[model samples]
Target: MSRLITLVTAMIATITTPALSQTCPPPLNGAVRLVLVTAPDMESTGGLLQLFARETPAHAWTPASTPHPVRLGKHGLAWGIAFEAYKRGDEREKTEGDKCTPAGFFRIGPSFGFVASERHNYITIKPGETVCVEDPASPLYNTITQRVQLAPETKADNMADTSLFRNGLFVDYPSDRANKRGSCIFIHIWKTPDTPTSGCVALPEPQVKALQQFAEGGAVLAVIPQTARDRFPTCLPDMSAPHDP
Candidate 1:
């Protein structure tokens, strides 16, 4: 009887280990809310983004909402200064105008939209007047501010009239002051299912709105490549290679 019990216990452990390993990792910083974005592969610009909720840190993550289809950068995935940089060497690091979406964990920044929502923390954009500063030399670099607030000589990308910026969630990238890490990363409305973005993650307007409604304080976003999903947050990229310029 003792031998049977031991064998059964070992069998249960063996069966459950792989299953547990396949579950999505916990939200960063112990956040109860998470947005999980998973692509088919590192080079694919299309994927699924899902919102997850956990009652407590000890509980497993459960889907808070349906999976939403999303479009990524035209050039696909690349390393960024945020979560990826810590895991992988900067060999394939993203740079300004690289057109590759930075893949890693991120804290969802302030929500913005042309229309206002009282439920979420939203920043309203003034068409033709709002701009997201991408110029590295400017004090407002990698930030969204009113054109009036910028220095007279500062050059910035006007985001006021763009549909992509009409409704969006900023992904905190280039968390440091270094200019080479890239800028203006966001999750925004896509033009179409076939359309890809400059670097932001794009979803339909309805989906974007849904995300805005579901996301709350202490939310985190984790972009996981399909190839790395199983081994993520554990098997990091090789760090020996020199960083890209």
Candidate 2:
């Protein structure tokens, strides 16, 4: 009888333990929904200066892997982030180049992508869509754009400039250092499930999975330079006001 009771207790423990351990709890307690950027210096991380929403203290909730030096947009004027989340190819070392990414803030967004695993998602952009790249007259020039092909290498031809656009993040060229710098920057997914990017930051599969859960239109990401964090204001009202034409 005692052996029978022990066996039953063992079975119950096994069943209950597995279920209890597998469940993921909500985000860390009181972890404000703000985007946090980290630099190689470690302490330099946490440049959470931008305000994402008006109602909540959080400006945005970005993955822990989002890159630094967030950029802000100029004209279209919405909060945005520029990250090294996606790379052009499988080579991880490609991200080492200095010119691979833009430095300052730019208007970003209008989330795009098909659903992946409900916990992993990404925005898709082609190679020649003509996103803004700081060009003066190119309509959508100086803004985010997508191109139709992958840039084999970075050069005067493949660089993020005014001629091309990638279907990812928008570019905002401040007047101080303006030019037709071409575009095709993206806020897409990593090359591999566990891979990092060339010039964009990477989010865990789970965070992106939460994208669809947020309210639309009012969402925006603010990317800025490491220096800009201290200079710019923290938190802003939802700039995506309703359009009335």
Candidate 3:
């Protein structure tokens, strides 16, 4: 009987080991700078955003900026189009019109603002020219294009919306139009402290500008819900730390 029990125990462990080890790891990809966002769960419309930086992969992530309150998608978060979570078919994937912000690591880059930068690929949102195509059926979906160049029927964000996007960083979410994973995700200004966004992360005007200055072209952003935060890398900062500005 003792021998039989031992055999059964060993079999159980073998069967469950793979499941236990399959926890999705943070896909930082050697990022030296990071913007980490976390919410309570899939239905939360707000969360905390913090920044961390390191010299290299071997260096520890030190706090770059203190935690700040940010408004999230009205419907909460879903697994992003990138990384293991969506590929494994284990979580709800972010899709077009889901009203949920995508959770994953993404690159931050070339800014968009009222003024253009001759030194960088910074987009200058011209009132009549700029538009971000959100229509999945359009061949130019997910791209920023000129209104005069696109079909007159194309549906897109004006991009010149000074109210919400006077200045912001484009979150390089790997959403494909064919997949209709999602589109137009960004870290722009919020309308109010308590207002929720339509699938993008929204911050205060100052923070949005500061983030653009800090991003420096290749910063990675990780958006994880509280339940899954522990599985990611250990760069998460302690919220209790006294560093708010």
Candidate 4:
């Protein structure tokens, strides 16, 4: 009787240990939806981006849409200070005007566009009417503000003059409200496959349109570096699980 009990216990442990070890990491907790952006390396400006959705946190991510080719920052990627870093005191590897795309998990914020009646979720913009605050000395640094809100002499980038800002979604980096980690990170329209952005991710216009239709508020965009791809399962285990029949 004692031998039989030991055998049964060993079998149970074998069955359950692997499953529990494969649980999703903290970054993905409570995220029922996500967008994964992957590059070949920290220096590669081109890569594939895909959107995924799940019915619940415990379930696997299903392909919500097709993968889109995208462009990253001109200088490549660097680690940005986000929620996880804020708690742990990780050093920020990127700075303002570094021209490097930030690699981390960021919440998706409001969309902005030039057309008032555009078929997407975005704030309307008139030429020279919108600006994103990049001045660290100002209280609104790293935020998007209307031109009317600023003094005439205040330094800010004109979002309208650039065709890229005609339609775009905000990426909420620097999750800490009080500190300025980086500014004006966005997913916007790309000029061409060969052209890299200042620090934002760029997609072709048609894919940008598709993204506008697919993305929802409160979703997270996770930028994972290629060198770390092997460890991705430890961070997002649902993606590794076998599909349900």
lDDT: which candidate is best? 3
- How much does candidate 4 score in TM-score? 0.79
- Poorest stretch of ten by lDDT in candidate 2: 71-80
Cα-based RMSD of the predictions, in order? 7.3, 17.6, 8.7, 6.5
Return whichever of 1 and 4 wins on TM-score.
Answer: 4
Q: Candidate 2: list runs displaced more than 4 Å.
A: 1-52, 56-100, 114-178, 192-198, 212-215, 225-228, 233-245
Give a tens-digit lDDT track for model 1, residues 14-109.
776653224334335466777877777667778877787777654567777767678888988776674453344333567778888887777788
CA lDDT of each candidate?
A: 0.72, 0.31, 0.77, 0.71
lDDT of 2 at 111: 48
Candidate 2, residues 102-189: lDDT per residue as tens digits?
4333433444443222222333433344232333333443333454422423122223332112223222323222233334344433
| Clash list (residue pairs), candidate 1 | none
Better of 1 and 3 by TM-score: 3
Report the error of model 4 at residue 1, Å: 20
Q: What are the runs in model 3 whose C-alpha is more than 4 Å off?
A: 1-27, 84-91, 233-245
What TM-score fits each model?
Answer: 0.78, 0.36, 0.82, 0.79
Rank all candidate structures by their TM-score, best first, as comma-separated numbers. 3, 4, 1, 2
lDDT of 1 at 175: 42
Residue-level lDDT of model 3, residues 86-110, one tens digit each, is 3333556889999988887787767
lDDT for position 65 in model 3: 86
